[model samples]
Structure formats: structure tokens, C-alpha cells
Target: MVVSVKRDLYGNGRLVKASDLSLGPRQCMPSSQSTATSVIFQQGLQDCGNTLQMTSDWLIYSTNLTYSPTPSRNSPIIRTNSAVILIRCYYLRHGNVSSNAIKPTWIPFSSTISVEERLSFSLKLMNDDWSAPQTSTVFTLGDIFHIEASVDTTNHVPMKIFVDSCVATLSPDATSSPRYEIITQNGCLLDGKQEDSSSAFRSPRPTPDRLQFTVDAFRFVGSDNSMIYITCNLRAVAENQVPDPMNKACSFSKSTNLWTAMEGTSGICSCCDSMTCATAGQSRRFGSLYPGHSRIGKREADPVKHWLLLQEHKVTTLGPLLVISTEQSQARTVTPLSSLVQLWVVVAFVSLSLVILTIFGIVGKRPFKLHCRKAGLK
Candidate 1:
């Protein structure tokens, strides 16, 4: 993120020069913070460098206000405290040169910055190239659906999102009955084991916040031409954490003779064969979709519980994707009528009615005229 200062920012009726402002730990003039040069009267600072950002390369950084200790990026934040990244930029309106780079008359200008904590989740259906969203929701049997599930916490800490479970249901409610479980037991791809199935995750993920997968489309055996909604349970963790059995996406690979993970460390996928990848004794509790809690780093007396914070999760759904067989699709196509076709049908009916009425009028008049001629002859 870019940090900038205005040129005309004045103190005591004097303009603040660019070199007078310093950022980072020392707060010394001409601060040597590499994180992009501070914007000012140079290179159109009005556009790009007007606002100050609190992040450097996606990680939040902070500088001390009291001490000249080195700038640190590591700090613990809990529920008691706000999730703010403190930054201090020294603007020495009046200072003197000294043996040390720091000025004795330096003044500290501090700003408290915090990222948004709210998170949003969604599941999307993509087309072949994954470049665009699928326009047509109708899919014939044996077709494939390219799915992407993600969590969005725009300015919050970076997180690695995982699809804990994915099940297709006729209803929007994920817990509904007559469900077809595709990915279950905390990221195991059950459908991937089927014969001739191409269901698995798209490897080389673009980001940990999004997961891509392909599922061969099909409907419930007895339910044909039905609407199916795919609801997936997605969870997220800190990006720095490692992918464990519960948080990794695993797919069965027939060619490799072992289960594989998209995030690597295939050893975590070994239990996928037995469908026991979830943590021991932690069964999926449908009693509550959101069982645990939202606050991640609570200030608890129990240290162990603090470190083992519960990850955030959301149940995101995408579909009403029409599932139909080839025969059904063909029948629907033949029976469907466009507005133009319907308008033509109405026009034809009106014209036929007018022709029939004209013919009847001519026939009735001819009979009357013939009778009148007979009477005249008599």
C-alpha cells in the first residue's frame, strides 16, 4: 500500500517539505522505509499518493511511538484490543542536526489503522476456461460444472479458505434431504473415486482464498429434469498456517495409486481413502450450522484454547442449476415457443376466422338471390 503526504501541509505558517517527513521505526528525517517512496509534489501525487495505507506487501506493519526500537511486523492482538496497525510518521517542523540520524526536536505524528473484520462467502459456477461465469444454468447429464468457492474479507488478514463439505440438494437449504454428497468428511472428494469420473480440484490454485474444482453433473436417479442447488460449507484459516487433514482438499487419483491434495503434502490425504480425514471425535454437527463462534482471537485464560482458535466458516450455495437428460432437453426444445412464434399463431387464427365468415356470407346471399329469381319467373 502506498503512503503519501501533502506538499502544502504547513505548520506555523510554513510549508512542510518532503524531506522533513520520516516513516518507520526511527522516525528520522529522510526515512529509509523501502515500501514505495512517499508521494508528494512529485509524479502527480494528487492521484495515487494522497491517502496513506497501513500494509506493506499484504502484511500489516507498525512503528513504536515511545521507543526507537526497530520496526516490527509481529504483534499479538486479542479481543480486548482492536485489530489496528499503528503507524507513526515523524514530521519534524523544527529540528537540529545531531550525531545520530534522529533529531532531538522531532515530533511524532501517529495514525491508528484497522482492517475490516467482516467476511463474506460465495460459491460460483464457471464455464470451460474459468474466465467467465456460466451463462446457462441448464446442464445435461454427464456435463461438468467448474465450481469455485471463496471467502472475502477484503481488508482483513489474509486467510486460506477450504471447502469442508459440498452436497447437492433439490432445495436451497444445505441440510435438506435427498442429498447427493460430492465432497464430504472435511474435503474428501467422494465422487472422484467413481469410474470414469473427472471430479477433482483444479491444481495450482491461484490463491488460498479460492478453490476450484470440477464435478461431473448428474441428477437424482428418480428425479429427472430437476433443479439442483449445490451448497458447500467453507472454512478459513490464517494464510501462514499449514493445511492439515481437516483443512485440505483431497481427491482420489486413479493414476497415481494414492489420494492427492491440491495444496501439496499428500500425506495429509492418506486418511481420505477411509473417509476419516476430520479431526478425531469431531463429527459434523448439523444441529447448528455455525456451532462454535465468530471471534477468533479471544483473550481467554486458557492459553491452549487461545492458540487453538476456532476457524471461521460459512455455508455458501450456488445453483438452481437445471439438471436434465438429453431426451428431456430435446423434448423441451421442441415444445418451447418464442414470443414471435406465438404472435404468428394468433395472426393465423384471426385470418382463418375472417375467411370462414366471408364464405358463409356469400353462400347465404346466393340462396336468397336464387329464391327471389324463382318468384319473379312465376
Candidate 2:
């Protein structure tokens, strides 16, 4: 059988037909045997190519590479708190039977693959007053709230954000009907895209063209204390090119407002694909290979299709869970304790002095009169 030998040496390798070699090994070889070798090389090229493909897959697998989004290409590598590298060393030694043989039959290959790190996007409940991302906070009734999704342009690839579905539960129980109307959604768009002409934005608008975008800036007037669960779904793609509308993997109706449940028709937003569905989980996961610089050109196809490719596509959910409590207005009057005590003491002293003076006049005046009369008679 013929087999084709292929090697990529980064533009340094070459191929030579054995027939063209004038080496002593070729000279000693018989013509029929050399012809048979050539035939084998010619006939088994397809099978050899298949074998190489399988070998490459295995090599990538051994490196522990993952497809989740992660820091790549000169960006500062910020690993998850749970992230750790596994080091394994193998040792081998052998004595060569012949000097003509290659010194080593195999070489070790090492690669860094980030594992178990999830959720490339971050969800923050924006403080309207401070305009900063907040993990947990308290909100009162009639408070305008904004939920922001910040994508790390340095570490992660940018994608589209949609206010998938939001429900405010009056109680912690899952069976409660989530009121979607209490919190009204207004502004949501892709970064660099045109803003809503209605000028309905209540929260501070995000800086344009940045990796970050507001998933939904909403105002929730709480009629009662409840938990607000907002699910913001992201459709992250590697290539900037948008696929044909018909071929989109995920979609939703344009008329159906994302704040509400997915309806077949009559919603405000549309053109959603099948991949666009509401998902709920405590936290999401993101995975990517480290030292991505080494494998740049090797990724020709989109990362969505190949697990080893730069992890080109990621669909993650940034669900910002918030609690809204009813604002109670209790009137409290604060009095100065020092001034009040002084006033009470002064009033008591004046009353006591008046009582003593009245008693002295009533008793001592009569006694003095009687004594004076007795002295006169004597």
C-alpha cells in the first residue's frame, strides 16, 4: 500500500521523492522494490490523511483544551477562583542499538487548557445613582432599576444581548405567578447600534462601542415585597458577520417584548431563532484554552463547529437575581434630650420655691403677730 507523508514545519519542511535520491541507501535498493514503495505512497494518500486528522484530534484532547470563552492572545490571564493547573511529568530513557537510528523516537508536547471556568459575561444590577455594577443591593418601591451585562472585550468575544424573560415573584416559591408588568423595559440594543428614538432611557446610558451593554433598563414599582428574577440571554458569535436571517440558530418574535414570555405572535421584538430560549441557572460556565497565541492560524473554521478552534461562539445567560422590598414610611420625631431635661428641672424648681414661700407666710406671719402682741401687753 502507498502512503503519503505530510509535515508542517512552519514553512521549513520539504518533500523529496526517493527515486531522485542519489544516496547509497537508494543505490543499494532494487528497482522493483523502489517502484513498489512509490506505488504504496501514491495509493494510500487518503487513508494517511484520515489517520493524521485522528491523530491531531487526539493530540488536542490530551492537552485538555475546552471551548468555553476565556482570556486569549496577550490579554492578562485572569483565572477563576477555582482554577488550577495540573502538572504531569513523564520520564523515559533508552540505549540506541544502532548509531544510525534517531536519538529519540518521540517528543513530549505540553499545552495549557482552562477547565471548569464558566460564564464569560458578568451580570450587574446597575445603581442608578452611582452608575456602577452591583452584585446585591436593596431597592424600594417605585425605584427605577437597570440590569447591565458587561462583556470583557479583552478576555471574551463580544456578542448580542437580549432581555430574554423577567418575572417578579411575590414569594420565594417557584409556583407563584411572576408579574412581568410591574417592571417595564425600555432601552436594549447592540453596542454601537442606534438608540431608541423615543428617548425613554431612565438610567444612565452605557458608553457606546464598548464591550459592555445594558441588557435591560427597567423600572419596577413594587406593590409588595418580592424577588425579581431577570434572565438576560446572550448570543455570542465569533465572526462579526450575521448569518442569513432564515439560517439563524436562535430567534424570537419581533413584536414579543423580551420582558414577557415567548409568545408565538403579538410581541414587540422579533426575528429570534430557535437557540434563543429562556434558561435559568444559578451560574453559567465559560471555557477556553490558555496561551492561545500558539494556535492562532491553526483555527481556520469558526469555533462554533470545532471544539478545538478558538472557542469562537458562546451562548451564555447572565441572570441577575434581585430582591425588591416594600418601602415603609414611618414618621419619627427626634427631640433634644439635654434641652428637654433642662426645661423640666427649671419648672420644678420654680414651683417648689413658690410652695415654700406660701407656707412660710401662712405660719410665720401669724406667729410673729402673736409674739408682738404678747410683748406689748407685758
Q: Give me the candidate number with maximum lDDT.
A: 1
- Weakest lDDT window of 10 consecutive positions for candidate 2: 56-65
Q: How many backbone clashes does candidate 1 have?
A: 0
What Cα-based lDDT does every candidate model obtain?
0.63, 0.32
Query: Which regions in candidate 2 have their CA more than 4 angstroms from the true location?
Result: 1-119, 129-131, 153-176, 179-223, 239-327, 330-378
TM-score for candidate 1, residues paired by index: 0.52
Question: In angstroms, what RMSD does candidate 1 have relative to the true structure?
Answer: 22.2
Across 220-265, the per-residue lDDT of candidate 2 in tens digits comes to: 4534333344433333333342322211222212344342222112
Error of model 1, residue 311, in angstroms: 2.5
lDDT of 1 by residue, 287-339 (tens): 22223544433455443355335467777666567777877777767556566
After superposition, candidate 1 runs with Cα above 4 Å error: 1-116, 280-310, 330-378
lDDT, model 1, position 253: 90
